[model samples]
Target chain A: MTTLTENPNVAATADTHHGPAKGLKRWLYTTNHKDIGSLYLWFAFIMFLIGGAMAMVIRAELFQPGLQIVDPHFFNQMTTVHGLIMVFGAVMPAFTGLANWMIPMMIGAPDMALPRMNNFSFWILPFAFLILIMTLFMEGGGPAFGWTFYAPLSTTYSSDTTALFVFSVHIMGISSIMGAINVIVTIWNMRAPGMTWMKMPLFVWTWFITAFLLIAVMPVLAGAVTMVLTDKFFGTSFFDAAGGGDPVMFQHIFWFFGHPEVYIMILPAFGVISAIVPTFARKPLFGYASMVYATASIALLSFVVWAHHMFTTGMPLFGELFFMYCTMLISVPTGVKVFNWVATLWRGSISFEVPMLFALAFIVLFTIGGFSGLMLAITPVDFQYHDTYFVVAHFHYVLVTGAVFSIIAAAYYWLPKWTGVMYDVTLAKAHFWCSLISVNLLFFPMHFVGLAGMPRRIPDYSLQFADFNQWISIGGFAFGLSQLIFLALLIKACRKQGKPVDAKVWDGAEGLEWEVASPAPYHTFSTPPKIK
Target chain B: MTRANLVLLRKLVLVVFGMFLFGFALVPLYDTFCEITGINGRIIVKAEDSDADKVVSDRRVKIQFLVKTDAKNEFDFKSNQKFIEVKIGELSEVSFEVKNKTSSLQLAQAVPSVSPGTASLYLNKTECFCFSQQILQANETVVYPMRFFIDEDLPEDISLLTLSYTLYQAQSVQASYSKSELDKGAS
Candidate 1:
């Protein structure tokens, strides 16, 4: 108060200095949402690469039916750790990183509602993943119980380093919860005047719902892992039948969290697609209200459908019917979303930018994944698909093609805004086509082999599955290599090698984010912009 | 960041804590749900009926016995008769011989589960060796007896049921152990 009265000009000058700081401290100690967002994106990408490499090892081992590159145990570790890293370390974090960068900009807030909390959440992820990866080198190797880590397998037969895995997952849960709280608070309070609930961008709306899902389920995951920890180390039998508990309860509790978790990874992708599809098509989205409701409905139905994952786990017939029907019901809202995107593209001036290409692929492939999920929801049919490569193929289409591809799309969509330079168009196109073909090749064959009775998480397969496995491995390698083009494109954009882009880099792009200068000023909308 | 926002923040934090407790609550909640729905195939004891002497002699049902032992703990477990045909409402007895292959004293328990899950409600155990821990001397073999009956009310469509006992070895079965409220791995 005294400074404003005695030296008003000095206070004014300090407030006007909005450029970023000079060195590594700018990232390490800064609370700037953009810087922290960059940190998270980089961390997620690195984790993605590590997880993808593990997938490569898995595919290589499966290439010829007999273990060639790694032992069976190591291959189990690869599959388990690969799942853990991708779900927690790659897809979830990438969505969060995008929220940090874009949410405040969309809502016209100067920064995240709690900037320090943002930094804390991002920093813990690397450490948590480090602890998890460290277990691979420890005795007994990493978790071989698969990512689901069901009882008996997780409890009786798990590696000695199970405690480390539990603690690492616990850390991730905490980080996610804290990150979610920040998101909810930011969107709830920081919208610019006149930017009412319905007026907010689809990205912001999806994130708001996703934040709730995070808060609701991440704790359940923590509880599940805690039970696993106690059952193994503390002599408790939360999932042990001999001790008056049942292992089937583990599946119930886990899928409660796990099912919503599946949506948490994809809901934001819905938001990204909703935003991009309209921008490229040059159409004000076909069914914005329905899209929001659809996202909400999908989230709500997620709780009831968790048991669909456990259909073959031996649930009662009624339970099976209920879950199967509920799982299929999600398709209703999901179909609404798919329809909205297609409708937006109908009779519109569509241009296929790199982001649009990924978005279009996301819609088609995610639908395929959704359809397969529906197929598995039928209890009797799931018995056939359970533990098979078909299950593997289903999730990858949604995750790699759905959630992951959307993240890549968002990055390309906004990279010009964040970097002030365009990414190399030709290289990006090549990256897109190669990824499109290879990703399909990688996941598509798994469906065939899965249906043909090839169980997943095995290092060796029968002679019959040999050909499809070869094609799958080749596809996996190609997909893995294709990502390098992305890495190169990103490096070039960051170096400002490409031509500069003005604010509103895309002709039809619309948002507060584009109203500011390219490479958005370090402190934007300092005085919140009015929506009108 | 603002006063109203802080309130929102506080409420969200409470939701986080509440959800954590809710996760733990699901344990008991699950048990209660399973008990009510009979979804998990937990065998509930039935009242001794005076009419139980009327074993439906003409109608035949097959009882297949299965024992599951952890491969880690070297042990031999076998049902004396792999299967037996008994009339509905008939009392049947089976013996399982288990030997502790390990050289030290070890504790073992068999958790029984009925398959075709709905059959769990139709079957009642007169005496079964579960819940109570079985402590055997080093390399000792023990034969445990189980007595059970298929209730006359068992569905006509089902003629066979598998009674599986999953054998587990623990240092101890804590006295604090209680039946999980509702669910069993029976299915």
Candidate 2:
């Protein structure tokens, strides 16, 4: 339908015939999706380490209760920035990076539809985060209002850093929107001649839906942060209850963007797991159509369930029930997904490659997170679990084991394709096992402490929680160190230290990405391959 | 990638812009939603131009006043009368005494909420100090007046309604009231 289709061979020859430009300039000025993809992945890894460092501070402070290394205010900043960095900087970008590296290849298309815009999106993230990080050194030490940044705490009581925090988040939102738009346009217009809708890879499918979700919600987040800005600096009382605006209203608006924003993080992981599970199991994904429908349903349900986050905000009885039931409804489709994954593995020839093993862990751990989420969705019980360590444990399971684990799986699954060599299996497996065990050690007891009435986001706790706190801290440190192993594996593979491999790196691998050469070339599918 | 797909790209851009506007739209939308559902406990009733259709029922509901202030607020605020009994749908009046013990011009904003939660929808205030900030000159003691009527539709199971006002001291709260009229016609 475009000039790219006019003379496919010419387009292929022109872009692919030349090798990548040299040095740092390739990364600085490049529009190639693969280059941009690598940039996003590496940047996210660094941010992960930075955010993880903050978590270490939090765990260390909580290790034995009463004020130790850092003061309470600084501890608040640690929690706030840690959450902001991990959600926005690490997980979201890593998934987008995956989308960039893999989507065009999987769909047999030539590059993302708007490659230049893709570069711009990936580039802006570091600067946006810099603006946010700049806040810590500012007068009041960053936003201590928690990542939720609820009203009054973010407004009347916040330090001068709020303006900078708002601006940083705005730039990040812009990057996400541009990135999302490019993904949507590429998937919509650039698929190969015969790669019809259903035949597309599950990763491509999940990303397409996620792109729409990003477009829909990122602006809403922009709106939320802007209100926070105006309330603090511009003398607008959009959240000040004394000024005809209710603080509780901010929670409603924040979660409206917030709920879907969460799905945006996890849905891509769903697609990643969908791809990895079947490949290792040597079976077509069971309930394929149901999986698609379930993803869509989960996205739809995300919009309605935001208020469950605000159950304790004194919302009307009806609203609490409505949101609670809506949240519970999400588990239905989520349950469908888990059953489908297990069904795909039923008595099939399954091998525990690193990717498959991570995917399996994701299924088990994310389900635990989901079940806890279900428990929280009950309006009455949520009153108990609302801000406790239980809530912390619940999300870490989903985000770490669920989203982060899936990302690690995707990275391992495609590493050979990207690097043209097989990474050291023993080292990778060693990294995996260490991470799996330590992560559980780190997060599992959070449920007990949380359930035992230990509130989250606090610097120190009473003597009763001191024992659980120590074990949880140990887990936190171990999990943080284990990520270093994955980094070494990545660095070694990138340096081409592994054994060389041909196309179709894994024997059970399917789809168009596997059909391409190992190392994937500087350009992929410049001439769209006929599907069928 | 293609001409037709460029059209899709354009539409997606529109969706992004539209959702941005929708974000702003949620403020008014949430206000409307809460107003309709009587959730969020936001008090937004204007002086009714006319409630001549009101019916005064025989059912008696005791209205109690609860006042609270943040740590910084040292001003003395309390309803002069501890509690008052009013028939359902009948207009009733009560007075609150606010003593600005602090030695400077202060803008005090009072936020109101009703207990039993559902009572917020039925408790209509026609004239109240919470309608706007009460500006008090140094040590100016103002006894503010409030008038209200409970809707006849007040459910039978509720007999006691607690109307609470939370006082906040602010240097400025998004308005500029004239100093000359600060104490006009108040006791």
| Among all candidates shown, the one with the greatest TM-score | 2
Residues A143-205 of candidate 1 have per-residue lDDT tens digits of 999999999788978987999999999999999998999999999888889889998899999
- Per-residue lDDT for B171 in model 2? 64
Total clashing pairs in model 2: 2
TM-score of chain B of 1: 0.81
TM-score of chain B for predicted candidate 2: 0.80
The TM-scores, one per candidate, come to 0.93, 0.95
Q: Evaluate residue B135 in candidate 1 and report its C-alpha lDDT on the 0 to 100 scale.
A: 80
- lDDT by residue for model 2 over A144-164, one digit each (tens)? 999989998999899989898
- Kindly report the root-mean-square deviation of model 2 from the true structure over all alpha carbons: 4.6
Worst lDDT 10-window in candidate 2 chain B: B178-187
Candidate 2: segments with Cα more than 4 A from true spot: A1-17, B49-53, B70-74, B169-187
